[model samples]
Target: MAKGLKKTVVLVGMMGAGKTAVGKAIAQILNVPFLDSDAEIELAADRTIAEIFERDGEPFFRTKESQVIERLLNDERCILSTGGGAYMRADNREMILEKGVAVWLKVDLNILWQRVRHRNTRPLLQTANPYETLRDLAQTREPMYAKAEIVVEAEPGLSVEQMAQKVVDALVAHGGIVKDT
Candidate 1:
């Protein structure tokens, strides 16, 4: 339907939680821009996130991440997909709350594992015991993720379009968007 957004939708969650995928679909539905904080950071750093972590480390990458998030939040309202760890910081969470409505895509551990297990792109999951690592991350981050303004539970077997529509419906219900979902 291409309904426009009244507020920026900041997609936040774990690495395999479908933030980027659902965000792209949401932007298309809303006729708005889809901005990924991680992608922006990569463009600014001229390197991959993995490379950034390898060379400069997580703290440095997080600093650049905060800067990029601030810049994007100040731009036109868009569907902003953030890195998995972005919402873990208090400053980042505060800024997101002020400028946009945060949507946490809550997915089950098994589903998240299935989605990300084969992918080497996630720097954090590159561990000796990747499955255990993913489980631990989900456990640790769930509390922070629960602080998001809107929580959209991602059910298994739903297509990206379906998941996006669910988010849109949630936004309308929460008054985050003035649109027909």
Candidate 2:
């Protein structure tokens, strides 16, 4: 990591894992722009994520997601929070790894359920049993998420600010953020 080179910090994890919130905080701390993949998709498609899923389908949504992510990766300095399923795909994960540092916001299943249970927006978890769905998804994606350069656990009792600070620290520790000489 050259000090003069621009760095992009990409946050990857399950839905409701606080990637958007924490990524925004990290970007503010680093004084850089923050881009949420879902928001970008919504802006480009002129429809909410749920609407995209409903009207088109997961495959269609994923295609748009890949396009948005590809565009975002071109930014030299940015904090990007990707959709939950984005990193699960091999090509997407490889692209992030090649372009920047990927950080996995690891959250426990119980905590994830608590945060997202009431939300009706998650297309993947729209099942009759969202908890089980979350558990299965988490299990399946854990290995993929582990491929990230940095991993920060989003524990209970930590404010978003605290989580953001932890992410910054992890980035420094993992050599993701190099100080300009």
Candidate 3:
């Protein structure tokens, strides 16, 4: 299945868009490696993303995020799930475009909120009003995410496997990243 891959498929979107889950499913379907940039960063730093942000600040964390993304894009042709903010940086966007195909998992704000509200793993949502924060972040990031090579709508009714299939179908129809296997 890996024989037809030409570039990495980088999943980008707001938190709770199921990037990691869908990415895993797609990688499994395609028989390719699956990587999550946030998980990679946490492993490299020997700490969680929240701890990295709290200890070194966002700027520092973003620096590391950029480096990790750059490395991942260059490392292999696989499915990569990036952090919510990863595509916001111009440098990261450039690298992703150059070396990989960015697939935005387009999910609405309300659905995103429902999926993420109970999760304490998101450091950015630890705020006085997390819903408002998420809304603002979504508004700010949507335009940039729209610049991705492929956009896959994430319906609330779709299971993770279903969403992954939707993305795979899009990639196949678009004929940009994932090659026919």
Give per-model CA RMSD. 1.5, 2.5, 1.2
Model 1 residue 132 CA deviation (Å) reads: 0.7
TM-score for each candidate, following the candidate numbering: 0.96, 0.94, 0.97
Model 1: per-residue Cα lDDT at residue 92:
97
Q: Could you tell me which residue pairs clash in candidate 3?
A: none
Tens-digit lDDT string for candidate 3 (1-181): 4535688999999999999999999998888899999999999999999999999999999999999999998897999999999999999999999898899999999999999999998999999999999999999999999999899998779999999999989988888666766
What's the true lDDT of residue 90 in model 2? 85
Q: Rate the local accuracy (lDDT) of all candidates.
A: 0.92, 0.87, 0.93
**For residues 37-153, could you state the per-residue lDDT of candidate 2 as single tens digits?**
999999998999999999999999998898889889986668899999999888898888888889999999998999999998898998888899999999999999999989999
Model 3 spans with C-alpha error above 4 angstroms? 1-3
Model 3, global lDDT: 0.93
Q: By TM-score, is 2 or 3 better? A: 3
Q: Whole-model lDDT for model 2 versus the true structure?
A: 0.87
lDDT of 1 by residue, 1-181 (tens): 6677777899999998999999999888888899999999999889999999999999999999999999999999899999999999999999999989899999999999999999998899899999999999889999999999899999989999999999988998898464544
Q: For residue 8, give model 3's deviation from the true position in Å.
A: 0.5
